[model samples]
Target: MDSLPNLLWLRSFEAASRLGSFTAAGVELGLTQAAVSGHISALETRLGHALFHRTTRKVDLTESGRAYLPAVRKALQDLAKSTENLFGGKISGAVTLRAPISVATLVIAPALAAFLESQPELNIRLLSAIWADTALETNIDFEIRLGAGQWPGCQAEKLGDDFVVPVCSPFLAKGLKTPADLLKLPRAHILGFDDHWPRFFETLALPVHSPTPSVTVDTSIAALEWVSSGGGAALLLERAARPLAASGRIAIPFKEKIPLGQGHYLIHRQNAPPSRPAVRVTENWLRELFGS
Candidate 1:
């Protein structure tokens, strides 16, 4: 096409098509019904085809309108997204990253400050999920999840290895000498993970005959709390247990760390709605800090 239709005209066409009336489109666009009709008429003159079929009670999309609506809608969407990405409200940036509680609290929380310091304009929001291994969430800017680094409509990068290691209070930890010693204690199963205790036993060739849990909890944080009270031994992610072990609140009685096979992945849903530069900077910081 040599000449493009005016945006106001295209807007009128799209609004009228969507709402099924020029009067309603005019109401929406703050124009009179005649103005909406005039826009469509001018557009029809330019395009050499009528976009709407009109009657006394209603208006309907013509065959040409049906064909053209999708492109026009997509073009409008692209323009809006481009405007938001390039020049929208990011003077003082805001980014929301969602991750598992253990990873968020233990792994990233300690190091997140330095990242913010480096990029002084950002306000970072960390949303904690107990079961963070599932699907991509809408409106989440970044995700740190424990999984196989795969999801639809996303970019998943390997953050690092995660291993399941048994942890308990210092007093209880001192009493254990062998893998067999663990079998006698009550086991607090972290519910979201694989059957870690059974796998942990089998990894050491210590047979478990119908292994049962003393307690079950959804989050590693809860399991850690239970173990710290000397309630039972809980198998926890190595990253989750690392800080507490350093503080002497919990102890890793055995040297063996069972590979989880899956691990924490830094995931970004690529351009579903494109991210701003600050969020992109935070994404890079997370990858650099956590990625293997």
Candidate 2:
């Protein structure tokens, strides 16, 4: 029993069983279909057990194979990830970070250059998508999330509050003098936040009505773009809209703003301890940036 089957054969068998196609496994493993088949056959011969039920169209894992597949797949993946961590290069590895597209583009992307300069060896892979509850578990090292500051099963740090105010293009601000004047100008809405308009109206002591908008966007950044392009006024976070305000593209119409909770947080999985570099860099940078 000292002479075990090749590790490559186990990898090929695991991939084939998981993917349900030798050809697909070959594509993933960078081997030919014949080579993958040979590896699986070799593993089966060594183990004296058929691992898969092969048919004309597909392959299904046998009971023994199903039992063995998870451990094999996890081992291989852990090996690959650990190898990347160990000898990848320059005492640096990639940090997979996730954030909303608006925050990523407006806030984080601008500050990234300075961070990169500070840590010349490290690499960052940024992912921007819709806010999801399960983001920390999805192969991401860190996530910048905007919500009510109540995320469970994650280590959380408050980034800042999201102060939302009505803003429009500098050109559109000509006739808009007060909150009452806002009723005349075309408005823009961000979907899934139906209370944004209502909250603003309530703050201004106006009755809630079905407000018509010139444009509706799924993301806040897009709404800002519309406002900047002279499309209409938008309710946007002060942190994100400040740059455009500085550039003379947009102007906040009202002095009174609605506090939309602590808008952003940096979160990571609670179960897994962050790597040394990840924790150090993230914690220091956030403290410097947000004064936390």
- After aligning candidate 1 to the native by TM-score, how far in Å is the CA of 8 from where it should be? 19
Tell me which residue pairs clash in candidate 2: none
Please provide, for model 1 over 180-290, each residue's C-alpha lDDT reduced to its tens digit, 9 standing for 90 to 100: 889989998776677788888988899886488989888877888899999989888787677789899899988898998797777876434335567767877877766
lDDT value, candidate 1, whole model? 0.81
lDDT of each: 0.81, 0.76
Error of 1 at 160 (Å): 2.2
List model 2 lDDT by residue over 259-292, tens digit each. Answer: 8755688787753432445544655686566542
User: Which residue segments of model 1 deviate by more than 4 Å?
Assistant: 1-92, 132-138
Name the regions of candidate 2 deviating beyond 4 angstroms.
1-92, 207-212
